[model samples]
Target: MTDPAAHLLIVDDDERIRGLLQKFLIRNGFIVSAARDAAHARRLLEGLEFDLIVLDVMMPGEDGISLTKALREKLTTPIMLLTARGEASDRITGLEAGADDYLPKPFEPRELLLRINAILRRVPSVSETQSAPKMLHLGPIRYDLERGEMWHGQTPIRLTATESALMRIFSACPNEPVSRTQLVEDLGRDKGVGSSTSQERAVDVQITRLRRKIEADPKQPRYLQTVRGAGYMLAPD
Candidate 1:
């Protein structure tokens, strides 16, 4: 058999689903980790850099969307949300909430594999060059895109993989508004949010985290401003 192409994290409340998905994904050539819920997932994330995260939306507490939002603060691993709710609005909501892809429940495992492959395809290969802004001025913070490093004055500020990836994406098109859906796609995350409120709620958490780093006050963001109805924009000075 071929070696595993990537490492995967599977988070679900249901023991059965988690076990099945883990076994299936491993068989298809992936090293898999399983988490019982948000708390467990958080612990796993702190210690691992996963290639992808397969998350189920409905859970006992701190549901998938909440976890997704929290994870985006520090990780760029791809996420695919699975749920029993299959409404069209639900799917759109998922995208708005910063999910890369969404699949309804009772889906064939093969279909999940196909979707996983499709999302992985969107990721740039290691050899591909992602030319980025040499140095970004985020108020007092200076970020080096190529090095994935950040500095406040002469001191260095650590950036998690997710945070570094975010800076790279935003710097690529400074002064441009990036929709939550686009950001989700760029970050390679997938999860569920069924309406405008849900979408904004999830996206807001991520933006808030980013703002705290560069803004004098995250509550009243000066650098990353909301675009009324459009989306979030990064205005670097």
Candidate 2:
């Protein structure tokens, strides 16, 4: 179940579909907002923060993929693309653009609900009460386990939802290699959504993005290392 206060932004050019999704998601315990196109979505995004974004791929002005890529430059909000195109390449393109998930058009509301909940579940929850901070050090980077935040000295670093999830998984077992298949399962990418290979590749993309934040040089990562024939491992200092 998703947090009842979880806010969602629905961006679709079609009024009928946008209205229907807003009503459906609201009925399912989400606070929903609707946008007719990417421009409207950007306007809303500037003033308000949303737990997740449900974006349509075929918008008139700026398409979902372009908006997603742009938003990822500053925001860490999770985005789920709704695409009419079902090709694996299209889905991978969405993932490459930093979308957390993609649901092809003509999907059942229930499946969307499931996917939304899964992504929300992956997001780390902040406790109202404070506890001693558990820190993981990677070069100059510091990750707080309890708060699910990363820091460089006094400045905070932003992490997307999927990147946060991956950090949680790796931080739990530092210096241990985790297989691509296991990483897929931990990230909640179920079978039948896309081929296993594509899902692993998506994970690779996410890892590359994350390395940019944690490693001094992403191309030659020192903390997040790849183990030959095994998988990736986090060796924190």
Candidate 3:
């Protein structure tokens, strides 16, 4: 069962569908908010943070794909797109836009609920155990596996939620090559969040961001090195 207090934002141009989803999700133990369109969603986003966002692909203006792209530029909040049935191209486009997942229209409420739970489960909970030192020494930088915190000497380095999650995944299996598909899945994005091209690009962006903090030379990363045709590996000293 999902946490009742988990906040969710539902954005759709269709009033009936929006209302129904809001009511259903609320009944299933979520704190739900509804927005009529992308513009309204943007307004709500400015004032509040959400655990997840459910967005519809078709809208009067600023469709879900465009909004997803905009949000990905700054936010790491998980997003799920609703697309019409059999729209493979649409799904690919949505993923390219940085959506974490995509659901087809006419989906069962139960399936939606399940998907939501699956994504939420990926977010690590902050607890006492998280503070322990499973430290990875990377030259001038240090990453605490337990706390998911990175530090440069006495000064702490800040990481986005998505970056932290990626670190956890990599640290859990050190020196192992994790495929892009596996990383996307572990990141709690739907299989359709993006096409291979988009997902690859997203991974590259994240890797670059992470390397800047942990690597003495982001241009020539030694700790976070790419494997030939395999994926990426973290070689913490």
Candidate 4:
């Protein structure tokens, strides 16, 4: 079963599909939000942080492919595209546009449930291994490795789901440079997302956001250092 608090956004033009999915997912222990089209999905995204987005590829105003492409520029949230078209090229196009997975329409709800759980499982979580440090310090901010929580002195700081995942990935191997390709793969993005260059670009956007929380000055990140030819390294003190 997935986390009961995990929120999902469902975008589809079909009212029946939207309602049915919302009801089904909620019954299975998810908090579901339904949007009728791409425009509605955009509005919800602007004001909300969803664990995942279930998007339909055939929306009227802005198709799922287009919306996925635009959202990828800023968000690292996992996206699963749903469409009636089952062609290989369509699936490739959706993945290239930054969708994490594509589920062709006419699929069983149980199958969808399993896919969603699989994708969520791939999201990096806290490292509780005996070898891992219990805490990580980044100047003024402190991270509890076991709890997956961050703090600045006595006050707690909020991190988005993706941000928390990045910390889990980095903290596991501090002072070591992790290539963007590896980070993308670890984040559950398939090779179908595109070339290494494009994949790295997506990871870059996410790193920028993470630096804002960990560094005193994001423009000159001290804790999150960029290696010359390598990738990013977390040099926590």
Candidate 5:
């Protein structure tokens, strides 16, 4: 079973298909959102983070192929294209456009579930493993990934519940950019209406506070660096 926590975005011009997919996925233990076309999908993308995007290849405006290519330029989210034409060439085009997987139309809903689960399995989680490094030193501050504790020498630096949650998310994917929207979702604040700007801003504030606890120079961060167009990344020593 895929993590019931995974969120998916469905893009299709057809209203009926969108609604049916949304309901089916939700019933099968996933959070689902839908967009009418490429333009609508872009608007949602700005404010939200999705685990996977299930796109329909044939659309009226801004076909799925074009949007899939554009999305690859900015985000690393996985995409699965649904095309009515099951030809080898059409499938090849979708894959080359940067979609992680593709499915032909008239396919069973059960098959869609299987594909989504498979893709999500490839996403790495942050939970510390016995094998992965546990102690991370960032200058004077030290963190225990296993215990989610921060220390300054022998003294412990306390973290709020929200701060602790952020640490876990960042530690799980150390040296990787974790989008602001994904941070909000991982923190359990994404309520599914859309990605909340208020929540995004909240994450920024939390990052600032976290810097104060760890960075030797919070003014010029060395560990928690912001990726220009992406988001924040935690680079531990």
Candidate 6:
């Protein structure tokens, strides 16, 4: 059974598919919203937030992969792509494009439910222990793990949703070098959503934005330093 509180966005050009998916997922206990295409999805996205998105690869105008790439620019919401193509190369393309996961068309509804649950399971749960004053000092910035808050001296630093998610992921395994692939998967973007170059670029952009808020010198980051080819590691003082 799906979580009734889990909100899902279904995007497909085919009305039949969209309606069927919405009804089926709703019956399984999810709150679902359907969009006819990428354009419609964008409109809905501007006004509402979803726990996950079910996107169709083949659409009239903007394809699922393209929209996935665009969304990865700002949002870290989990996205699963529905595609008719079953080729391995196509699957790779979808993952590289920034999709968290992909499902081929003509799939069993049960399988879809299972995939959704699996992804949701991977999302870390908030703990009461996180409310303690366990803090990490990063130069002039300080992060309070329990409160999920960051501060610079006496002032609180604001973080975007994506930035906060990244911080939580990093704090869960401090001093460890987290690979880009791991970060992408944890962020809930389709693992098959982007090229290596695209994933690297997106990670870079997020890192730069995060540094501006947490680092005294964003250009020469001391706390969030890169680890050669291994990936990024957060070295808190």
Scored by lDDT, the top model is 2
Which regions of candidate 4 deviate over 4 angstroms?
1-13, 16-115, 122-129
C-alpha positional error of residue 66 in candidate 1 after TM-score superposition, expressed in Å: 8.1
TM-score of structure candidate 1: 0.60
TM agreement with the true structure for every prediction: 0.60, 0.93, 0.72, 0.63, 0.55, 0.62
How far residue 65's Cα lies from its native spot in candidate 1, in Å, is 7.5
Tens-digit lDDT track for model 5 on 1-237?
768988899999999999999999999988899999999999999999998899998999899999988987677687889989866556657656766566887888887887777666544344544556888888888888777678999998865445666777787788999999887667544532223675565467668867877888888999999998889999998
Backbone clash count, each prediction separately = 4, 0, 3, 0, 1, 20
Show the colliding residue pairs in model 1.
Answer: 79-190, 93-193, 100-189, 100-190
Each model's RMSD to truth, in Å? Answer: 5.6, 2.2, 4.4, 6.1, 13.7, 5.7
Off by over 4 Å in 2: 126-133
Q: Model 6 over residues 1-237: C-alpha lDDT tens digits?
A: 435689999999999989999999998899999999999999999999998999999998889999988997777687888989956566667666666667887888887888787666545345833543378888778887766678889998765445666787787777888988777766654443346656555566667778877877889888888889888888898
- Rank the candidate models, highest TM-score first: 2, 3, 4, 6, 1, 5
The 10-residue segment of model 1 with minimum total lDDT is 121-130
Q: List model 2 lDDT by residue over 1-237, tens digit each.
A: 768899999999999999999999989889999999999999999999999999999988899999999999899999999999978889888988999888888899999999999899887665521343388888788999888899999999989899999998888788999999899999888633778988888889889989988998889889999999999999999
lDDT of 1: 0.73
lDDT of 3 by residue, 1-237 (tens): 656789999999989999999999989999999999999999999999999999998898898888988887778788888878435565556655666567887888988998788767656555523553478888888887766678899998866556777788787777888888788777755443336666566666667778877888899889888888889998888
Model 1 lDDT per residue over 1-237, tens place:
222578888999999999999999988988999999999999998898887888999999999888877776556677788999977666656544556668888899887887777566554333332565567888888877656677899987744334555666677788988887777666544433245454444456557666777889888888888888777887887
- Top-TM-score structure, candidate number: 2
In model 3, the runs with Cα more than 4 Å from the true position are 85-89, 126-164, 179-231
Better of 5 and 6 by TM-score: 6
Off by over 4 Å in 5: 125-237
lDDT of 4: 0.81
